[model samples]
Target: MEDGTKFRNIADLDIADYLDKDQFARVLNNATSIELESGQTLFEQGMPARAFFLLLEGSVKLTRLSPDGNEKVIDLIHPGQTFAEAVIFNGGPGFPVNAVVLSPSHLVSIDAAAYLDVLYDSPKACLDIMARISQRLHWLVNEVDRLTLHNATYRLVSYLLDQTAGASDESCDVCLSAPKHVIASRLSIKPETLSRTLKRLSDSGLVEIQKDHVVLKEIGALKKLIQLETDHFPCTDKKNTLAVEIH
Candidate 1:
């Protein structure tokens, strides 16, 4: 059987969450499974994005090139996440970034033209999908706010807290999804800066590093640290006077 004709379990696809039963079956009928190796290019920056993907295993990084030819890591994708979905609806240029596989990865590529065909059959589904995508857009907007408005330590704290996976205990064990340098890139910080931040965090009793794993000694303290950063921003002061806001 060809790659596109191979039978795949619907349960393995995270993109299925965005559609109803009938729509999922329709889309699945046109899906294809692809396995890629580490250091492989799933799609380049300008390649025609005819489909979106659901990663079942391993990791991928979305990146863009600057005018000076430096690559900036946009986001690191882990398993159970759908990527390139925006391109299907973008209706403009090709994919906005290059999606490179960081490890051996298994993914399901959904044919965008087929997906749109399904949507055309049901007008309500189109609104539902767009609403869901728009809802998810808040995260991207907040990411922009984080990158441009916050300091390096705030971003690192937010990243660490995100890796905790909702551990309610006073302490939590976290494993990094990628190397220090890749992670630094994803966080938009220099590798040396990440190292220094980690050391400072370690010395401050906020966390302890063990090779690729980091143990958050005080998750509460880390949360407070983020809040502290928020509280201390000079532009966001809220006093006993008129309205104050940070742009």
Candidate 2:
């Protein structure tokens, strides 16, 4: 997994979206690979920002620790996504939050200087990165608006509808890729509240909750329930954007 050749073969990286083959190869050639077991720390909050990581395999959770030691889960970085790209250009030289391995994972740590150099050398690549950062900022604004203005049920229902986007079938399966509590934190809902909301949805015949998967029984009805809210607060496929590094 550490080999540059191995990195090249993973289509999920999709480096070609922004960089050409030659540029992509150069970046990987300069990258240093790091592997971690589940629950291991990748970097800590306030650590000097020296590198930006690409998750080659598995999942990583980005979290912020409060002064009193409370943890807020900001995002779950999945494979095929890059995290902390903004750190490369930030005026401050430290990470704003901590990243931990959600499962056994392989990551490529691209030196900040090397990445910056490539961006400087390629206008197209630099613009691509900036556009991604802009999109993420917009998404965060939408997320905050949803959390503050919407109720728990609205938020949870919106989340469930979002999961079924782009599906051909009327029904879709959503796997809770992380623990329930972690997903609750990401949604800014109390764990018990999330449980109650799911139970209500199940009782009403909207969705069926298995151990870790939620099967939408009536997708159209669920979507219609939230249509008005979604009209005002549009929810994009945040995952598809590929540049969010929320801490």
Candidate 3:
């Protein structure tokens, strides 16, 4: 268990991006921290959502389980990201997906009632959350567009290019943030299909796959192969394109 002071500090950190000293301190007083092991579930689909979580370390996979017992990965959460907030605010009976740790992880969990109280009392905090939700929706839209594109190679290469944001273009190495199976689920592609697409790209001298890492041999060739605008393929701002490359 974390000491009260440390718990409060983590709580303070969660809302620090949108709250001031007084408000952060108040929110901190009502928050707690929880640890999860790899493969442990934080929440399940159709379960009442009573709280929201801010991931402080490690990664969490958001997945939806179908009636036939199939699981489809929806997204991966990294540090500095909040999950289940929309469900909490929407007063929904259950979350739309299941959340499970991909690795040993630490999270700050805020009770829905407490968070809602703060949101009602703090207009700025509400605005901040609304803006964040809007941005996330925009990202989801782009992801849908990418998936709808008929070309599998385009989807695979576009996903790779997206991950290169903020990386040194000089280096060929690119780390994949998620396992191949999880990535395939998120992309709505089969693992075998993804593997074949990657192999084809490699054969064309476009990229190299080394274990969990990918090395872009010729980015220009990749952009052309994917039919994406060359100027927009790698993105001008590096950080925004980091996850796009390997997702």
Candidate 4:
């Protein structure tokens, strides 16, 4: 897809609501669109930072490559999410991690300097950018908490339970954002370990994994098995706030 079409697709997403039509058009005009095949590197750690990416289609994996040549997957980003926003202002170092396309993907890359200009020109855009950064930080913290559990089974089950919040109860189906190994890396577990954990969940009658879709047979029991404590994390109430800000 061209950069303009990719920007329009992004504009259709909820996150792009904060941008005005003119600003959005200017951003699209300044961005470069690229097509990446599976396993293509989008950016690497320690390289000069120049742009931030907005995923238009397919998935990208953000990973930190260790000195010993090991890779730790930090995040799996899908459509509508912006990556490397932190690099826009820091100007300290290049991307602290590597981003690679997990499948054939389309992305819109906005020059960091141009983006900063837009932010300075529009107060509302600045606030929206701040909110996005804050939201991403919050998610990273929560992901850390989820991975702190000692058992792989607990982590896998907890992940499934987390997916249920935005899911349809009648369908009880949730799509896996990436392949099993990629998700395993994100959870800091071996692929075999993830497979074993899934088998255990199935054996316990908690869920049924078919292809990339996990069908929840007993969500209540699965919640109980994971010992979920909902009170610890308050749900966000952004209906009116988002409506007013984006519109």
Candidate 5:
């Protein structure tokens, strides 16, 4: 993966842009890449946080098991995104959730100690990392506000709008990063509720579903719906902005 230009093009490795080529090479040298099959556990909660990971391909679910043995899906990480980042610095030296592959996946593991050493050597790189983390924190705060203030229908609609924020065409295809049940868990709703919401939106001519893909037929109407809700709820960054791309 470190074949010169190939590494620089990876969207998840945008951090390379902040460093000189030599510094980027040092960052790459300290990392190891591996492939895993579906149902594999990448890491577990409470384990020593020796490293953080980048999802080069496929998806991974970050989940925490509750006291009653129920699993709460925190997030479904997409390709070109990193997870367990907070553990290396902001949080303690332990993973707060379990990262399990939802499909056959490729990942790059960067040793925390080595990566931190590189960060300390470059002030600009450190500031860039902080900015990225701050973006994520903002998204998380909005996510919490969304969950607490909105109903299932509003949350689902808002999520659909967020996913299609950058699409250029009138209609766009959206595939769930994980399964329906996993997505429902992340949205804090039951699978049945998600199905119902999709059906409701489809009946209203907003979206159409084909197998696992949701073709958004009415992007304008969807945006208007979210806008109407935003007027009532009043979020800071309704457009998703840099927080969405920080993945």
Candidate 6:
């Protein structure tokens, strides 16, 4: 499907910002544009990785199927961002996750081989690409750390605190862009547990859930709560170790 057409939206995306005119044109010439409706899956986990994409509009979720037949949310991609980038370097394999459109989306899919070919002549472009991949890798590492080293409440609170830190206004509001279950999966907790955590925060005057977003009413309390949860988490692991001494 690569008939050498122009992808006009490339100029505004961060991926294109690193590419020079010739470099940009090369990718466009080797790319295919796609439009898909909500609930459409672009690719499945373990599917061959022949291409990557720049989302021109709408939201997308990258998820993986766990061994227990459950799905885990890996990331939520926004407009102007790229996804499936790591697959290009995955080396002789398939995509690590499934890419599903959350809303009607416009995307430009660039052939992996063509994109890699252009990088050889552009050191800066290569570095930019690696940075994006590395950032995702870092997030994955932190995700593992969060899942294993803390409780569900601790995870949810930390998630809210992070969202609040990234907010642009003083309201300290966090938006729930995905379904509650999806968000819960991302935090490694159940949907019911997420609701209960939110309810408890609301009851304690620490947060207000008006609709789709949460307002952090007392930022200081949340900070303290997160620390308390971390330090005083049920001592199951520590308790096992102390069993010999106590007995």
RMSD of each: 5.5, 7.1, 6.3, 9.2, 6.4, 6.2
Q: lDDT score, residue 14, model 6?
A: 80
Off by over 4 Å in 2: 1-14, 230-247
The candidate that achieves the highest lDDT relative to the unseen native structure: 1
Mark the 10 consecutive residues where model 2 has the least summed lDDT.
238-247
Local distance difference test, each candidate? 0.80, 0.77, 0.76, 0.75, 0.79, 0.78
**Model 5: per-residue lDDT, tens digit, 168-239?**
637888887678898888989898888987887787777998887888987887777666665665446745
What is the TM-score (0 to 1) of candidate 1? Answer: 0.86
Number of the candidate with higher TM-score, 1 or 6: 1
How many clashes in each candidate? 0, 0, 11, 0, 0, 0
The alpha-carbon deviation from the true structure for residue 244 of candidate 6, after best TM-score superposition, in angstroms, is 25
Q: After superposition, how far is residue 94 of candidate 6 from its true place, in Å?
A: 1.3
Model 5 misplaced stretches (Cα beyond 4 Å): 1-8, 233-247
Q: Candidate 2: which pairs clash?
A: none
List, residue by residue over 88-136, the lDDT tens digit for candidate 6: 7858579988999888898888899999999988899989888877887
* Candidate with more favorable, higher TM-score: 4 or 6: 4
The sequence of per-residue lDDT tens digits that candidate 4 reaches over residues 35-87 is 89999999988888888888878899999978898888998888777888798
Candidate 5's TM-score reads 0.88
Lowest summed lDDT across 10 adjacent residues in model 6 is found at 238-247
Best by TM-score: 5
Off by over 4 Å in 3: 1-15, 217-247
List TM-score per model, in order.
Answer: 0.86, 0.85, 0.80, 0.83, 0.88, 0.78
Question: Per-residue lDDT for 1-247 in model 1, tens only?
Answer: 1333233454555466657787888887788878999999999987888999888788999999999998889999988888888778778679999999988998888899998999888777788788878877988899888877776778887898988786984999888878889888888889887887788788778899999899999998888767766676344444311111211
The total number of steric clashes, by the backbone 3 Å criterion, in model 5 comes to 0
